[model samples]
Target: MFGIYIHIPFCRKACHYCDFHFSTSLNYMDEMVDAICKEIALKADRVSGTAGSIYFGGGTPSILPATALQKIFQTLEKHFDIATGAEITLEANPDDLNAAALKTMRALPVNRFSIGVQSFFEEDLRWMNRAHHAGEAIDSIRRSQDAGFENLSIDLIYGYPLLSDEKWESNLATAISLQVPHLSSYSLTVEPRTALAAAIEKRKEPAPTDAQSAEQFRMLMARLQSARFEHYEISNFALPGQYAVHNTNYWRGVPYLGIGPSAHGFDGHTRYMNMASNATYMQALLRGQLAEERELLTDHDRYNEYVMTSLRTMWGLDPELVISRFGRSYHDYLHTALGKLGSNDWLISGDGKIKLTTEGKLYADHIASELFKVDEE
Candidate 1:
C-alpha cells in the first residue's frame, strides 16, 4: 500500500524557527492551489494502487479556504483509488481552528488532526512568535474534539531558552488533560538563516543547550510512558493503535507521493523532491511539467537509510532482513559493528530484535552512521 502527502505552502504568519518553504503573502493563493491541483493530476498516474493514507501537511494546511481544500480532495478522488477508511490527516494551527472551520473540516475526508500547539504557555508562544495564543490552543482542541474528530495528535516543543522544566511539564500535562491520542514533540533547534539563528547570533536570544534538551526529553518520555503512551518513535508518542499512519509508512520504507513545492516522494527504488520556489513550481505545472529532481538510490544508500530510520524507532534493525534483503556482506558487517557498539552499552538485543536503550536513543543518528557501509559498487 502507498500513501499521499500534499504540502500546502502557505501560512498566515512566519514562526521564527521554521525554515519550511511557504509564503505569508496571499497574493498567489488561488494560483498556488490551482497549480497544486494540476500537479496532482500530472503525477496521479504514477501512484501505486491502494492509497493507505493521505496527509495535508504544511506551512499551515488549515490556512487554505474550504473550497480550495475540497478542490484538491476532489482532484485526488478523480485520479487515484484512495482506500476505504484511509488515515487522512490535516496539519492545522490553533488560530485558524474555530468551530465553523472544524465543522467544515469534518465534512471532508480529514479523519486525523495534527494541531501545532508548540507550547501551552503564553511566554513560550510569544518567544516562538506562533500564530496562536495559549487559550486558543486549548479551545481549538476542545472544539475539534467536540466536532467528533477523535483521532488527534498535538505537537509540543521543548529545549528552548525560555522553556523551563516546569513549563515543559505543564505542556505535557495540558496535552494529557485533553486526552489527545498521539503526541509529536521535538527539541527546539536553530536552523541556519532562520530568525531564531540570527537572534542568537545578535545576542538577542539565548541559544539552546544539549544538557537542558536531554533532561527535558527524558522528562517527556518518562511522563508520557507513565500515562500509558508508547514512545513509538523518538519524537512521537501514541496510545495503542494510534500511530500516525503516513509517518509510520515512511519509517517502514513504504512508497508515497509528496505533492506541492519542496515536497519529497519515494517509490520503492528512487526518491524525488519538488522545487522549493512557489513561482517556479506554479510555472512548471502551468507549462505541463514537474520541476522535480530525482536521485536513484544505490544499495548502500538504501541500507544506510534503513539503518538510520529503523534505529530511531522502538523497533531496531533486523539482522535477518539485512542478510536476506541487502546481502550476506551487509549481514556480516552488521554483526561486526554490533559487536563494537555493544561494548558501549548503547544498544540492547533480545527476542531477535535490536533496540536502543534510553541512553542510546540520544545519539541514535551517530550510532546508525557508525554501522554504515561506505564502499561504492
Candidate 2:
C-alpha cells in the first residue's frame, strides 16, 4: 500500500509564480533520469510491500521523451513489485500532449493523467508565462479523453491578479464540460523570491488581494458542490470513487518513497529530502551516496504533522489511533484542545472522529496550530 513519486526537474518554460524546484534547461535530462533510476534502486529497501500507486510529478513530466519515460517505468517495474492495477499518474503540460504522444502513453501501464491546465484564457496564460495556450488546454483534454483516459484530472489556479471572477467561473465550467473526474485547484500565492513576487515589488505586476482570493474560493466551493463534486480535501475535488489514492495515502501518514532531485520521502516517523541541486545529486549518486537530508521526528513533531494533514481532509483526526501511537498523555492533550475548539464550534466530535465544519476549514491551519503540542521551555 506504499506509493512512489518520481520528480522530473526539467520544464520547457518557467511559470512566474512557481516555486517548485525545476530547471528550464533540458541539458541534464538524460543524466537526471539516470540518477533518478539509480536513486530508486538505492532506496528500494525502504518500503516493505508492493506499490499501490506510482506518480510521475515534475517540472513537467510530460516534457520527457516517450522513450525516456518508458525506460524509467521499466526500471521501476524491474526493481519493485508494482500492483497489477496500480494507479499510475503522470503530471503533464498541455503543449506536450498530442495524439501520437497520448497513444504512446496509453500503451504503457499509466492509468491516470493529471494535466496542468491552469486556465482556459490566453491572457492568464501569458501573465503566468505558461508554455501552452488556452486552446491547447481544451484540445489536450479532449484528445486525452478520445485516447481512452477516463481517469483524468486537471489542475486549475484561481485568485491570480489577472483572473477575473468571470474567468475563474469559466475555468471551472470548462473542466466540468470536459467531464474530468478529478481536479486539483489552487489559489495563487506570491511566494517570496519568485518572479511573481519580484514583479509585484517592481510594479510590473499587480499583487493578489486576500479579499479577492477568499471570494473566489467561496465561489469555487459553491460551484463545485452544486456540480456534485466532493470537496474531499481543501484544494481537491473528485467524482465518486475518483479520489487520488496517491495523495490520499500521504495525507493518512502512509509511507512513500520519492525519487529525483529535491524529492521527499517519508516513513511514519522519519523524513528525507534529496539535494535540490541537480549536479550535486548526480555526483553524490555516482559516488554511491544518497545526497539527501534526513530528520528524526520527535513525538511533538509527529503529533503536529498528523493534525496538520488530517484536519485538511474529510477523514479528520482519529482519537483512538492517536492514543495508541502517541501516548495517553498526548491523547489527553488532544481532548483538551478539542474541547476548546468544540466550544467555539470550530470542531465537531462524534463517533471517535473529529472533523471541521465549512467555517472551520477557513482557519484550518490556525486550529491545527492551537492543537499542536508545544515543547517544554
Maximum-TM-score candidate: 1
Over 1-377, each residue of candidate 2 has an lDDT whose tens digit, in order, gives 89999889999998999999999989988888888888988998898889999999988999998888888988998899999899999999998889989989877888999999999999999989999999999999999989998899999999988888998999889899999999999999999989999999999988898788888988888898888899889899998889999999989989999899999999888899999889999999888889999999999999899989998988889988898889899999998987776567677777778888777777788999989999867
**Which of the numbered candidates is closest to the native, going by highest lDDT?**
1
Instruction: Please report, in order, the local distance difference test score of every candidate based on alpha carbons.
Output: 0.91, 0.90
Off by over 4 Å in 2: none
Pairs with steric clashes in candidate 1:
none
**How does candidate 2 score on lDDT?**
0.90
- Supply the TM-score for candidate 1: 0.98
User: How high is each candidate's TM-score?
Assistant: 0.98, 0.97
